[model samples]
Structures are given as C-alpha cells and as structure tokens.
Target: MKNVKLISLALSMLICFVVSAQERTITGTISDKSGQALPGVNVQIQKTKKSATTDFDGKYNIQAQKGDVILITFIGYQNQTKTIGDENIINVVLQEDNQSLQEVVVTTAMASKKRKATKSSTQMVQGKVAGVAISSGYVQYAPSQSIVVRDVVSLSPKNEPLYILDGVPVKSDQFAKINPNDIQDVKVLKDKDATSTYGSKASNGVVVIDTKNGIYKNLTEKELDAKLNIVHPAPTPNQEDYDAFVENAFESPKTAPLSTFSIDVDNASYTNIRRFINNGQAVPKDAVRVEEMVNFFKYNYPQPKDQHPFSINTELSDSPWNTKNQILRIGLQGKNIATENLPASNMVFLIDVSGSMEDDNKLPLLIQSMKILVNELRAKDNVAIVVYAGAAGLVLPPTSGDEKETINDALESLQAGGSTAGGAGIELAYKIAAENFIKDGNNRVILATDGDFNVGSSSNSDMEKLIEQKRKTGVFLTCLGYGMGNYKDSKMETLADKGNGNYAYIDNIQEANRFLGKEFKGSMFAIAKDVKIQIEFNPKQVQAYRLIGYENRKLRPEDFKNDAIDAGELGSNHTVTALYEIIPAGVESDYLNQQPDALKYTKVQETANNYNDELATIKFRYKKPDGDKSIEMVNVIPNKTVALNKASDDFKFSTAVAWFGLKLRDSKLISNKSTTDILKLAKQGLSRDSEGYKAEFIRLVESAKNVL
Candidate 1:
C-alpha cells in the first residue's frame, strides 16, 4: 500500500508539470472597430519576448501558455491585453486611443483636449506635439512645408508622414485635398511600438487624422463648409513626358531569328509609378516601363561561379494570363562583392541649385541624401561638391572620404537660386571627377536635380549629346531626380542613358538608403558594361514570341557584336529579369498576325524533330569595365513547362508586379488578370522577404484596389 501511494503521488506531480509547460497556438485577427483588418499589428505574449505581426490579411498565430496574457498593440489604437482561455481563436477589435464616445481628441499631457479647426491642420498642432516639427511659409504653388514627426524617414522632397483620415490610410500628398477645417484632431505615432504594425511602408511613422463631419452635431453644414473651405477638391498635378516605344512583336526564326537588346538595370519607372498610385492619380502609360518595373525587385538567382561576373538563370512556365501560351523568364545575377572589397571611388556631387529647387523637397532633400552617401564613404574614397545655378562652380575639391565634416559642411552651405545651367553643371562635375579620377576604380558624377534646365544648353538633344560625349571620358554618371511639378524626367532619363549611368527618382530618405546605403556596392561599382542579350527561338516548338517590356532597350541585331555600340551596365549583386510570352506550336492566336507567307526566293529548312525538346537558346555578351572586347555566355531553355502555381516565388512575384503594372496602365494587352489575382500570387511568392518589401507590395496592391 505504501508503494502504491508513492507511485500515484509521483504520477500526479508529473501530470501537473506537463500541463503547466504545455504551449498552445493562438490564432487571431486584429482589426479596427469598423472591421477593417490592420496589417503590421503586433501580437505579443505578455512578459515574454515572443511576438508576431499580423499578415496582409490582419491574421496572426502566436504560441502561449493557456493562462499567459496576450498583448495586442498597434499604433493609433488603445492597447488590449487578454488572458488566454479555452478558446483556440481570439478575435480583437482595437479602439482608437484618446477618442471619447462622442468627440475625437488627440491625447496629450496638457489639460486642453479640444482643438480648433484652422486653415492648415499641421499648423494647428505644430508646437503642441513634443517631437513633431512643422515648417510653414507663404509660397505660391506650394502648400505649407511638410510636418515631420520625430526624425525624417524619407529624403524624398515630400518627407511627410503617411496620413490616415477617418480610419482609412491616405497618401501623404493627398492630405492637401482634405480641407484642414474638416479635421477634428491629428495623432502622431512615432515610436516602433506604434509604427511596426504598418511594416516598412510605415517606417516613416504614421499620422491618424480624425475628420469633423458627424463628430459634432452643433455645427451646421453651411457653417462647416464655410469654415473648412470645402468648395472642391484640389486639381491634379501635371506629369512629365516619356518617349513612347512600341513593345517587341513576334519574330519568325526562319526570317528574323535573333532577338537582341541591351541590358537595362534602371528601376525609376516602378517607384515613379508607385508615387502616382499612392497620390491617388492615374498612372501615365508612358511611365509604365515593364522592364524597369520588373528589374526593381531582387530575385533569388544564383551568383556567378566562374570567370563571368554574372550567372544566367532561365525558367519556362505556363503563362499566367493565357494557358495556351508559355512564358520564359531569364534572370542575370551579378557577382556579390563585399563593400570592403570594392575599388576606391572618386565621386562628384553635381547639384542643381536653381530657383526651382528652393522647395523643401528639392535641394533640402538632396542635401540630406548626399549626407547619407557621404557617411558611407571610406578612407580610400574621395568626394567633390559642384553646384550650378546661373553658373557652375566647384565648392569642395577632391576631399578625402575621411574628412566627412568638410564634405558635409560644403553640402549644407549650398543655397538655392538662379537658373539651372544643367549642361555646364555636368561639364564641371565630370571635370572635377576626371581631375581626381581613380583609375581602375569607380569614377562617377552624381547629379541631383528637379531636371529644370532653363539656362544655356537646356534642350534635351543638346544635353544628351553632351552626356554621350562625356561617357568616352570614362566618368560614369548617376541622376537623382527630386520633387514634382516641372520635373524633367525625360531630360534626366536621356542624360543617364547617354552618360553610361543609372537614373533613380529619390522621393524619400528610405529610397536614398536603399540606393546609397544598402545597395552601396551595386549602386556605385560597375561589374560589367555593354551587356547585351540575344535569343534564338526554335521555330518548331514555338509558333510566336513577344518580348515583354524592354521597349526602350531594343538594339539592332548587329549591335550585339559591335563593341563600339554602348549598352547598359551591370553593377555588383544586381539582377536583371526579362520575360517573353510565347505561343506554343499548333496554338492559334490573333497576336500572330505578322506570320509571313512562304518565301518565294529561297527554300526554308524545317527544324529537326529533336528540336522539340529545346525551347530557345539565350546568348549574352558583356565586357569587363575596362575591357575592349566582349565575352559571351549562353543558356539553353528547355521546352519543359510547369504549372503557374508550381513556379518559383521569384517568378510568381515578378509576374504579380508585371500584372499590377498592366492594370495600372489599363493595358489592352492584359487578359483576364485582376488586382485580387495579383495579390494572391504575391502572397504565395512572399518568401525570403527579409526586408518586408514583398509584404509592403501586398499592402500596395490592396490600396490600389480601393483607389483604382
């Protein structure tokens, strides 16, 4: 009996220990009171560091003990803590913080809880918030200087916080369209706990704006309208121009066997398109460069292994738009080199300080961005500052990278005035760079401008000719475009294209960090130049093919072998993706209208039956930065195809982006694809998204659905 009792007691103790240590998975959705799901909300196990963020669908699953407390937190909302119970699923509705049952109030330590409506909402609470900074002035064609909370998140000219009006997140630029008097109160979420739930898009923080209508019953509609100046919405801003290029059409292997083009790594079009969508404006068709859009995102292609500076990857899959067609994806991954391994660089800051750049987002943002770049410079690197307004002048001359203070001071001392003599500025910048040129290293001129070239040599053709001539000097160029309203995108693009450099539109500091900091090696160091691609399709296996995007990159067939012809440059760790839509043999489509009649002069040889196993052969040619001759690489694509769902995440995600671009452009070429479809594919392909860019893309697509 004693032994039995002892055994029973021991078993009971072991059971209790097991129960206490057991963990259960808790699944839940975090949403606002209106039932809209919130992405990026933090769900944590109280007293423990374990946490998870709600996905794009506002759903999250976290493990916790049965009795442990679950803490749910999001910016702009009250914190909620609940004890885990028998329920396996817990759904939460977060209440807005500082909001009364009837009135909206921004919480602060002061006794004054009510806010008076004014002409500018930022002005009303400018000094009231501790960390919020506001710069306001009377300027024609420009609104009050933007309100920055805590630190500036974006170096882009419009470094404004993401605005939420009445529980709906709106673009920062759209705030001006909302009457300031209609605003009830504005709450700023600056800390990580508050902004993390919004993910990368909210890295700049968020502003929860409560509007006035229906909040107060005492105010009459007529009085409210008069007070708010709610006469009409603000007019849309004008967009810059782009040279229209037709998409590549199907070519017969019997006649035109070679599809040749220069490699393009510029990603300006994608972000520029994002700017249009976020601002609630229609995307310009010309701004939708499919190749640029696709190349913006990084892929999981393998790095170089041999003597080549890049590795070629190919994938053949069923077309997402049409099952009758197959899509071929070709990717080139540049070798990844550590920043420390990069060659010394000689950089010149060619800044446009014309009167147009006086706007907060122009020269000011440029200065901030340049400072970030300066911070990344090493002892071996050298920098010079050159400015152009009425005339071009060198402010700082070949300062060592170690002397950061000197370079920073020079950048800060620049003031905006005079007309933009862009041509002269380029000449001076190149001259400075050449003077301190780092042979066998990176010698480049960084140009920051609104692209408003109003002075001498302002014409696009003249500027292009000058940049083309300067390229022979071995000084590469990089164009950083800023601001809107009179932005010369066309002129800037022309210069970058002709100058053997890359172009980027820096709208915020996040972009500056992405280009100048995170991607420092790829942005500054050129691994290969004159990179070109030519593909030969097997006439037997494929009936027709259309090169998706790369409209501006198409080169004459003979240009592939001619070393004199200039092509795009590939930087360290850069990836370029191109897609081709193909119609399989025996498939009938109207797109193949250009099929040629039998040749009357010469007999055409039929492809061998064994050729059915091969789809196409991809050939690449590139030159070392200093090499005089081009080296070639070849990749043969198999005829095997995989189901769309079975394709790699890289393939799916790129397709999603391409489809989104199509919808944004309202392209007639788009089949039955929808934004919802794109979102679904993107979610499935959101693998290895360490930077949260793919997740942000999902959110962007969701927002686009509502706005479009």
Candidate 2:
C-alpha cells in the first residue's frame, strides 16, 4: 500500500510539471480606441524576457503558458495587462493617458554647467538626447534649423516636429530664434504623449519650452491657426511618368498558335510598385508590369548540364482565381557562375548630376550605390566616371578596381547642378566603355539617373535611337533609376530596352545593397544575350491563352528565329519567370468573350495522335555573350495539371505576384479576388525564403489591402 501511494504521487508530480512547462502561441492586434491600428506597440510576457512588437498591421504574436500575464505598452497610451486564459488570441485596446502624458521625463538630462556654457538652445540639445537629431538648413547659427525626437510621424509637410513655446505653438524658425538665456525648462513629448495631447498636429512629436516670464493662454483652433498663419501646403504635384501599355489579351490558339516574346530580367517594376504601396499612394496602372514583378524573385530550378547557359522549367496547375481555367508557369534558371570564374569587366559610371538630381534620394543614392559595386570589383576590372549636367565630363579616368580610394574620391566630389544632357552622357560613357573594353570580357555602362533629360536629344525617340546605335558597339547598359517627383520612368525604360541592358530602381540604401552587393554578379555579368522565348500551344490541349504581363516585350513569330533581332539578356545566376493563363479545350472562360468568329474559308486542324499528352512546346533562343549566332533549345510541357495546393512554391509565389499585379491594374480578365486571397496564396509558397523577401512581400500585400 505504501509502494502504490508513492507511485501515484510521482505520477501526479510529473503531470503537474508538464502542464506548467507547456506553452502556446498568443496572437493579438494592438489598436487605439479610435480603431486605428497602433504599430510598434511593445508586448511582454509578465516576469519574462519574451516579448514581441506589433508589425505595420498592428498585429503581434508571443508564446506564453495559460494563466501567464502579458503587459502591453505604447508611448502615448495607457499600459494594460491581460492574463492568458483558455483563449489563444487576446486583443487589447489601449486608452489615451492624458495625465501621464502631461509630464515627459527628459530622455537626456542636461547638466547645468553644460547648459550655461552652450551658446544657444540648439547647442543645449544637440548632443544631449540619445535619439534626437538636429540639423541646420543653413549656417550653424542660422535660424533655419530642425530638431527631431525619435521617429518622424508625418506631422507637417516637411515632417518637422511641432514646437510649443509657453502655451503657443511656434515654428522651428521661431524656436531657433529664441534666446537661450530666456529659456527655463525644455521637455520633449514623443509618440502617443504628443499625439494624444496636441492631436494630429503633434503627430511628429512636440518640443515644449517654458520661458522665464512667458504667459500660458488657452487659444481656440481658429486663433492658433491665425497666430501661426498655418496655410496647409497644397499637395505637391507628382511629375513621374511611366510607359503605358495595355495588358495582354486572350487569343484563340487556332488563329494564333504561337506566342513569342523577349525575356525580361529587370525588376524595376516590383521595386517601383513597392515604393508606391509603402508611401500609401495608389500604384499607377501603367507601372504594373506583371512579368517583371513575377521575375523579381528567384525560383529553385536545376542548373543547365549541357552547353546552354540556362535551364528551362515548366509547370501547369489549376488557376488560383478561376477554377475552370489553368495556368502555365515557365521559369529559366541562369547558371550561377562563381565570382572568380567571371571574366574581367570594363564598366563606366554614367551619372546624371542635373539640378533635378539634387534630392537626397537621387545623386547621393547613386554615388552610394556605385561605391557598393566598386567594392565588389577585382584588380582585372576597371571603371570610369562620366557626369552629365550642362555637358558631359569625365570626372574620373579609367582606373583599376583595386584603386578603391581613388574611385570613391571622385564619386564623393560630384555635386548636382545645371541642366541635364543625358544623351551626351550616354555617348561619352559608351565611348569610354568601348575604349577600355576587355577582349571577351564584361563591357557595360552603368547609367544612374532620374531620367530627366532637357537638353540635346532629350526626346524618348531620340534616346531610343541613340541607344540602338550604341548597342552595335558590343557594350551593354544597366540603367539605375533614382529620385521621384520628376522621375522619367518611360525614358529609363526606353534606354534599358534599346541599349541591351537591364533596369532597376534604387529607392533606398537597402535596395542598393540588394542590386549592387548581394546580386553583384547577376546584375553586372551577362552570360547570354538576345534571349527570347517562343511557345507553340497544341490546339487540342489549349483553346484560348494569354501571356500575362510582357505586354511591351511581345515579339513577332518571325522575330524568334531572326538572329538580327535584339532581345533581353540573361545575366549570370539570374532567374526569369513567365505566366500564361490558358483556357483548356472544351473549358470556357470569360476572358474569351471577344474570341474572333470562326473562319469560314479555312478550318482549324490539330494532329494530336503522336503528342496527345503534350500541352505545349517551348523554344528558347539565346546567344553566347560574345557569339554572333544564336542557339536554340526546346522543351515539351506535358498536359498533366496539378491542383493549386500541390504546385511548387515557385509556381504559387509567382502566380500570387501576377494575380496581385492584375488586381492593381484592375484588369477585367481576372476575377475580383481580394488582397486577402493573394496573401494566403503567397504564404503557401514561403518556403526557402532565406532572404526574407517573400515575407516582406506578404507584408506589402497586407499594406496594399488597406490602401487599395
């Protein structure tokens, strides 16, 4: 009886241990009482270091055992604690804490001795705060200065923090003009503290100042507005332009058996569209290039084993948006040649230093991007710098890549000014590239610009003609677009398309790293040139088909065989993906509403006896980087189709991207699928996302749903 009691007590102790150690995921959304999603809210499991921050969508997840308490805190909101219960999800709404917000403990304590020694208020706070940033628009003593506390919350048009003197709101200029001797105490209110007190005007935070003899007066909104002469600036007009092209339409395979187009490796559209979504602006319909967006991501495919430089992959699956129709994905994986195996390179940095490039995102970003590429170069590689403003000039002569200091010095010395002579810059850059060209090596000109050309052959047609002429010299072009508000995307696209080059938009430093650092070899080294894809669908298998995206890259059926015809280049380690929406034979789709009437004189015929299982035959033509002639390879896609759930991650991800592009374009062909569906499909293919790009894409979709 004692042995039995001992065994039963041990078993009970083990059960208790398991229950205490078990943990489950707790997910919730953090928002304010106004239903506005509050991002960056800190949530912590009580008495534990485990914590999570709300994402841009105001959602967070943490692991905790049942009965554990979670503490939630945001700067301007009241702190709340919730005990984890049987429910897996616990959402908490925080209320405004006006009382606690009224007193803000100074983030940086200023010593009285230092304050006395300082000449101005700016100096008093310059180095005191850990997070505050101070900058002078003019001279050091100039009244045009700006002070920021923590992150900017989009208050004024210039994103400046609100300045409150005594009880009256003042501008930064007024704050700067105040005498340091008259100031008594200064407090910085940030995050929710400022937002809740001053409302939207203090969204960027507030800098409250108390003067020796200043009076505090309660003024009405109208009185405050009149005192500040607050004229809300009109929205700046967007001067950006994109190449307009109609989305590809469905065609009957009986009438048009072959679909041909040039392969595009450029990812400019995806990044440009991302910029729009991030800025909470509607993406322009013309800016949505489905193929570019789909091809931006790399897919897992076997490398070529033969003499060819790329491998072909094909998959047929049920359409995600439409049930009756099917989708065909064609992927090409460019052989990844190691950096050591790459040929020597002769590169020219063609930069536009035009007055329009004065923005921080323009000329400055271009120089930083070039520096990244320079760091990757070997001793065998050489680069020359060419700048164009009023006229083109050689800022740096051809220097070996090993001379990093010299190259960076020249890049740093560049300043933006004068009119844009883009055509002349291109001419000079190509000349330099051709002169320093290495035999059987990578010869290219990297053009960094906002694509705004106002002087000397500035028209798009003129630029196209010039680029076409330069392409004959065996030099490639890589266009890197920068800046906004006057970005000429059409001009950049024209130059890239005609100059035998790829295009990318460098919106931020991270993008520079992505294009120039992580993707150095793929963006700079071309393995094959004039790469084209032509598809011949079996009429018996496919009734109507439409090539998604590539509306501007379509080629004539005869062009596929013509060696003289120019096409896109395949860079080393680059992957290109294309999608074709197909209406199988006997299956109907609304996309075929405008199908042409059957021919009366000629009858459509199909000989499927031998190739009954074949859905289509894909033909790829590409030329060796230095070779004149083209080599062709063919692959046959089987008629077999997999369910959407069973498709490869590459197919599902690419399809989700294409579908999102269609939705952005408001294409009538696709069903009215919401962004939620896109998000779900994208998450299904999140495998092998080591770079976290797929996860970022999911967040982008979430953001788009709210804005779109």
lDDT per model, in order?
0.77, 0.82
Tens digits of per-residue lDDT for model 2, 638-698: 9999999999988899899999999999998887577888988999988886445688789
Q: In candidate 2, which residue pairs clash? A: 76-192, 76-193
Q: Roughly what TM-score does model 1 have, to 2 decimal places?
A: 0.72
lDDT of 1 by residue, 370-402 (tens): 877888899999999899999999898898999
How close to the true structure is residue 427 of candidate 2, measured as C-alpha lDDT? 87
Query: How displaced is residue 315 in candidate 2, in Å?
Result: 0.6
Show where candidate 2 strays beyond 4 Å. Answer: 1-232, 594-601, 605-610
Q: Considering every candidate listed, which one attains the maximal TM-score?
A: 2
Clashing pairs in 1: 40-197, 154-509, 155-508, 155-509, 156-507, 156-508, 157-361
